[model samples]
Target chain A: MPSTEYRPPRPFSRIYVEDAARDHPETARVLRRFSRSRTVPISHYKDIFNRPRQEWRAQKESPALILAARHGEFLYDASAYTPTFGHKRFHYNALALNCVYDCAYCYLQGMFPSAHIVLFVNIEDYFAATEAALAEGPLYLALSYDTDLPALEHIIPYTRRWIEFTRTRPGLTVEIRTKSASFNRFADITPTDNAVLAWTLSPASVAARYEAKTPPPAQRLRAAAKALEAGWRVRLCIDPVLRVPGWENAYTALVDEIAEALDAGKLEDVSLGVFRINRDYLKHMKRRAAPTDVLYHPYEKRSALATYTAEEHKSMTSLLRSCFARHIPADRIHIV
Target chain B: MIILHTALAAEARPLIRRLGLKPGPGAPAPRLMVGDGTALVVSGTGRVRAAAAVAAAWTRLDATGHAPSAILNTGLCGAADSGRHPRGSVFVINACTDTTCGRRYYPDILLRHSLPEAGLHTFDKVIHSPEEARSGVRTAPELVDMEAAGVFEAGTLFLPASHVHALKIVGDALTDARFVTAADVESLIDDAIESITAFAAALRAFAASSEKSGRVLDESEERALGEAMDALRLTATQRARLSAAARHYRLLHDAPPSPVLAAFAARPPKSKNERAQALDRLLHALNGV
Candidate 1:
């Protein structure tokens, strides 16, 4: 039976402000939105966030907010586990730390000690750093590495800023991946070929079981369809395919649903991969999310990456690739 | 169990009466009170007494084989300014610094509470003059207490920092020190008992939820596994992986003594390499590696 208990939105009750960012215009703008929340000042963001003995599980129940001025390097080369999608200069930026949506399989659970969202209210700094990096060579920057930026469009318009910033710079390709269904934010703006709005699609069964508080798969497909209709380069990410019970039927139906809902011809690309996580991160996740089936998989560790055994990986990947081949051209499908 | 520490009898009197606690028999040196799943200790003033009282209370609770789930220090404090927060206003101490030792401690504010939070300065001597309170304000502490830092430091020795909490009621502002009487101290704490009770209940709920979420193995099981793995002469990495694999198996199947693990445990490996090989084989069998 479905639960009918009413749950109020768990918005942040406190916003920790870094001393340097207290006077920043972006800080003022963000604070204006959450004027009711209590403001606490700190010398650095880490003082509150990186403190020892933090209850990651309890904090995740209702995460607080933190605003800070990001110092030093803003971009980093993509991790070996992350696929570059054939881009030679593939890099990622963390304008924010941690994500808004809580997926049981998300690596952020292991990567961060605290679940509170930290938004570096210094977009100009990140842009300046990106411009400097781009001056040397062509850049393929994934702007939503640590966060689902588009999901926070109502709070911060970094996605819109990235779209506007990419328009002026040549040889700059940006990918903003999200599971958020808020695609109307891009309706008024003209789509740029250099920008990609990647939507992570999952089987409805898998999403319902693992992806908590995320938009349903059907809504995500509709949003992807809307983005394509807006002339935006839309990519479908079927990565992290979970092997739930009756997964084959679920994924097959998911492919059929995608074919019926979206124009596969207009898709920029389709990326496929099975469930995998950094070995260290899996350790952190196991302690907090022990009841989660997807996280409890006996995974094989290869060079610091924990994934299913070779046979399981091959079986799931091959099955997904064959399913994609039925609708999209094989050449357009990239398996990572 | 929730353990609450206070520096004076006047400070703990209202809570004891409200929570319906009786005089505890154990720990004769520092007066202890017990009721329900909570205990209260009255430590005399000063950092030394506070730290010693916390240690004694923890030892007594440990002797009873019941570790405290949460530790809280609730008492009266001198506020920097009366205009900002008048007497009887309760404040949650988020950070505490010892003026004598110059060391700082931060209590985890993971759980939500009804009282507003502020930083606290723990001075060896009470701040009486307005000039001293103004000087304390320059140090950036909203409230001045005598034992919060000591209580926090000692509580963290036995419990996680996240489970340690410190709450203070403004007994008097520096400007009002001359007019404040002993009756005022008890009355101020008495007035804030409702908020304190709510805070205690919230802490208990948080501790319960934390235990539910932290379903890492029981202490006995973890220790047994560690000893068994040590007997096999496994490397640190191998031990960690095998532990994770065991936890994964237990979570997925909701069953203990996995067949593959049992097989390995029945015939212990003779060498480190053999232990590593056994682990790999077990993980492969369990995880389909």
Candidate 2:
């Protein structure tokens, strides 16, 4: 059985700085925060991050920090499987590579070869690329795709900068989705309608069992409520729902708790998705996260996608749709 | 299993006596000494012998279906300065460079041991003179040894860099290298046996934890999932997913119901989507969701 004992966050003992990024102001600022850590200079972040024989599971226990400059393409269209929420143009950017939170079912376990977080110090490059894309036409972008930017707001403050940047750009719609409870960073800033603070919510029990180091559902809901009151467009995501034992009761209680906490009319929308993963990612996760119940569940695979049976997906999504429909309008819910 | 490699019998003697390892009868070259879930190999001296010995030990272990979870190279080394790091002080070799090939190997410092750490230079010959030691010092080596790089290279061939470790006890200073004797090497390693033993235990624990993370499916569960997939005539990807789903189902629930298996057996899924739908239903039913 997996241990339930709380493990404190392991600080980065080493920080790798890329030669191209070493002179940047952001790099200097981040380095100052980790003065005690031993700094190792490298030609590129991949020298250490992509080295052979790295134990992803073990490294997650104490991940190092990689400060690198992103030189190539910074943005890409969202994959077909990712829900676009009825947007005509949907895209995502990788400002950072890996996440700090260790969710058991996170696709990152397979997507990334290493668990170390790579924060591209040059945020201007990403903004420039997005602005260039917006020059052609309006764009809908997910800011925190590969990593949780809001959770690391205290470190990088990318979310705050993105919000400020979005204030000037009229054609750009930015979505910052996170499972973090660090919402106080938005207290001083004026909320923008174009910037949506999407909060990923799971049942308290599910979060406790599978989402390691993430804030509990109650805490996330409170953050979401705070965002709504701050005039920010907030999206509630009850996503990748696992079929854990007594899931119906667990989800029912979660929906009821969310309904009681926030103003239903204020939510931008609720996105519903049952547990699904890339087939290749599921294979890798199964090997790495063998002890976790959510990862081992028998899933159906179609066109490289692994998810619950179609019937199970329908029943679970329908059940949650009905539960959510009681409090909010049915048209506001998007199922994936 | 933990595999300990040493350059000399003297260096291995202290560990053998402390760990209660007995010489295995008819053991192959490299002198295998076996204990409870642990083995020690005397690699003689020089980098070539050390590398050969590690390969031999790994091969023997593999033949017996016992791959080493962790490999540790422990021996005496010449300190850059006796005044700085006193004789008999143990230092973990974080980086190993072979002077002959100019190839550097880094051992992952994953475990937090009690001993201090330093860079190691593996030289073909002993640095007897102060001038030679100074030349070695120009490379910024803290410790000088004969077999650390060789051991590290061979260890990585079988185990990951994280699973390989090197601990060097300062046997002599550059000025005192020629004066040192085999008895001094034995005494130096003997002096640090307590710390070495603790380090060995920690390495074992690390290896155990790593193994626990990459666990395979149980045999019975694997069989059940295979049977279910075969009945459905699913594609390769479908079979893999169905197996994962079955494993997930078993993880959350106590057991898989025979009725579900019988139902699946009676009317097998004909199409890929049908197979996926059936598998998903099976998991939900097993999880009682």
Candidate 3:
């Protein structure tokens, strides 16, 4: 269906999900294959006994897990970051894609054909590949390309797995990018010094509206607080800060929540980015969400992208930096 | 019979599966597909590597246990300019002239085939758009790819011109930059599989239909074969004589090489004006005046 055409969420009784442990066993388990029209024969459920299972059991199918199908062997991928705004990022890879949760602004929806989650079950292959790549030089790996880990933590348990995996590989660090505040799960697990638990945050109201199927902002903060309390390194992301109504209050309230739960000392860095896309994506969003003021903004063409006007991006980032700098140091706050 | 060959077996398996085929019957590495006459060869992904594959298949077919009557090169291709052609489509190059070596050849064409002639292009790197795609269209090479040269080169060693052809699906736009989606590209594979099936069926039907017409070759068949040899950049008369030698003379013996053609091949005689001057030079030499 055209993204402009509202697709009622699909629910499937059974579908095939590919995820395995023993590769990046430190990573969360990926479960896919349930959607609106597709169904799995009950025999398939019994056949599950034939395969191993992991913790990340994302429930929503079709627009849920098992997003699309692909035919190829080794994925020809390498670290690709913007040439200009080269964030202090060494490298990246596709560990997982099109998260289990459905956030409105997610790029996966436009990228993937099927909304079905595709958990590449061959964890060993990915691990061997990642480990071999890391052996070449010191680098950082970005995890949770599509969804937050903690939410699927109960099922996939990917972030915790990465924490464990990274500890074994020297000169390797990981940034588990996510919005889920399910940090309590790691309270008992040993925290890795090489791991940076980056918590993706949006204002409370934005989370409530756009971040459906995701934990509330407070819950994510609680998770961040637990990661801090557990002596784990941390980073904060105030990315894609939507210019919703009461934008200032929403962000201010979010800062207050973080201050209460997360201590400044525990954070390695903080990133504040205004909401943006490649503009073409916004066209679909505009059609999908008609008459939504947030969809239609005075974005400019920068680097062939429809981004916040220079002034808008500058103001949003500056305001967010100021908000956090009041509680932290200027060095700790970063903007991209 | 859809014969897909690659230097790599592992890479070809996924493509075969996507075509709704399963490795059938054979125990260790079964090339046999009981479901359909779809033969996939995993030629390693490269020029020299795939060239070896095409050669090996031709070798195997000649005086071997299993031999195929026809061949089709199938796989993904990076479009030089994919933005102009978003959906994956078929490319049929009637003639291919490589500018690097100044070698020209007509690749075998499946006539009246249901495919589009999108022109030719070259890729130094993975091309994603027309702006980035090599300007091969002016010469009108319907599609430009790495493996086709190997396929055409090897197919000529054995198969009749009617028995060989090259086809590809636009996997990525070949251009200066890259703009592609795996999800989008794979869907083109699906479309490719559909057309490939239809083309395979039509060719097979034609071949079967031709058998009923007896062993007497048709005039178009003779001309098509001649065109292929011409694309090989052989002089027209030389191509005709050589094709006749293969068809009627059956002369496998080494024939004396042509000195005049050899001299022209060595220097190409430059442009038409330069060649005209060369002709005068040649006439003076011939007349000894």
Candidate 4:
């Protein structure tokens, strides 16, 4: 049976603030938000985030918050694994190091050593770095690669700030992807042409089985519909489509449901990709995480990457594309 | 198994008696007591000795194939401020600092416990006065001990940070380390015996329930797996792939892949090509092709 158990979001019981970032305005604001949580001071966020022998499962159950100031290297070139949506200059930055939702296929589980959420309080620095890069040419930046900024909008107005910032910078375009359904947080903001609110919508069965602590697909569709009605450039991501049993029927039903709920012509684009990960990251994840069908899949390992065999990938992508092509134009469907 | 480490024998005596632990036959260096799935080690004074004792005891206990799941460091400590944490008050340490090296270790407290929590400072030398205590530690030292940092450093090497804990009983006022008599130390531990045993039990339960399930094969199936491997005559890479495939099969079906391998076990491959084909067929079957 699908899990109908209602899980109230677990609050951070403890907050670790870096000594240098203790007096930052963002840190102070977050402290005010979680006023009741115990605050511990640390020399650096790495002291806790990179600690040895950290139990990722236990920490994920009740994750703590670490606020620190990022010093250098705020922007990184986008990897081939992530689709760029036809952008020439694609880069991503991590305002937060870890995510709030615990998807079974999330690569962050293997990328970071600790499960604690580390929020960098220096947003102005990231903005300045982006502005510096935009001087040469047009830039497309991914602001929510390592975390769901929209889910954490209540904690800090990062998504709103980035959206407002992107409105004036004609050479800059930003993509903020999330599994959150809380669109009311941006009710007051003006819709922007350069900012894209990408929502990852999975099949109900896949979401129930693999995506933990995320809003249901129905709610996510409602949020996407609201965004589309508000004249925002919204992207529907059916990416990382899992090849579970009866996946074709599940994905077809999902596509039909989405078509019934929202107008397909208004969407900016639809992104599609099969599940894949770094081979080393999969090894680390398998060592630390409990057994799950997704993690334990015998993926075809090839040159630092682990993914389904070509035949399986072909079969999954073809099934999804044929169904999605019914509503969305073939030109608007991007296969990463 | 839950293993307890104490700096002094007096500190360990109360737990040994309360938990009904007896002398465990192993190495005689650290002096181990074991019974009822619990073990206690009397690590001598100082951080170095405590670290060495914990490492030694863990190695010895793990050699028997029944490895410890959790480790608890229980001992008496000096309260930096007597008014705040009075004599005989027990506390669960949330973080510990080593004064000599300025290194810190935070124990992930995931289990539920009723004891009050405090930060600890493990100093090499005892603080003789309030001034010494204030200057010796980097910050306000609520609880002062000599083995907490050492215990955490060594214990985490064997288990996860969540499974390593420290419970301290305040016995002095940060004036002198040797001020408390052996009887006084014993009484301090005796006063907190209930809390210690309860916390240990919670740790043991957490460790027991947190063990990963649905492994590729169990103890009873190891011999059969070995025989199958021999029958298939797989190379190193093929063997690893088979093991991974078996794990995936077990996760998907909640049953071992021995039944799938049983088909190939009776027929040995005559040539390298035949062996490769056999491996491919077994792998495809295990992978749910």
Q: Of the candidates shown, which would achieve the greatest TM-score relative to the real structure?
A: 4
Best by DockQ: 4
lDDT by residue (tens digit), candidate 1, B52-162: 998898888778886788988998888877778677888988778887766767666777655678888888887875567456343565788889888988988877777
- Which 10 residues in a row give candidate 4 chain A its minimum summed lDDT? A1-10
Fraction of true contacts retained by every candidate, in order, equals 0.29, 0.39, 0.00, 0.34
**Model with the higher DockQ, candidate 1 or 4:** 4
- Clashing residue pairs for model 1: none
TM-score for model 3? 0.45
Candidate 3 lDDT tens digits, A34-126 = 123222211121122122111011122223333222223322332231211233435554545556676766655444433444444444565
Extract clashing residue pairs from model 4: none
Kindly give the stretch of ten consecutive residues in candidate 3 chain A with the minimal lDDT sum.
A49-58
Listed per model, the TM-scores of chain A against the true chain A are: 0.95, 0.96, 0.77, 0.96
Off by over 4 Å in 1: A1-9, B23-27, B97-106, B136-139, B216-289
lDDT of 3: 0.53
Candidate 4: where is the Cα deviation over 4 Å? A1-11, B176-179, B213-227, B254-256
Per-model TM values vs. the true structure = 0.87, 0.82, 0.45, 0.93
- Estimate, for each residue in B67-145, the C-alpha lDDT of model 3 and write its tens digit: 5555666656655445554446676554444433434444323234546544343332343445434444334333455
User: TM-score of model 3's chain A, to 2 decimals?
Assistant: 0.77
User: How far out, in Å, is residue B113 in model 1?
Assistant: 3.2
Q: Judged by lDDT, which candidate is best?
A: 4
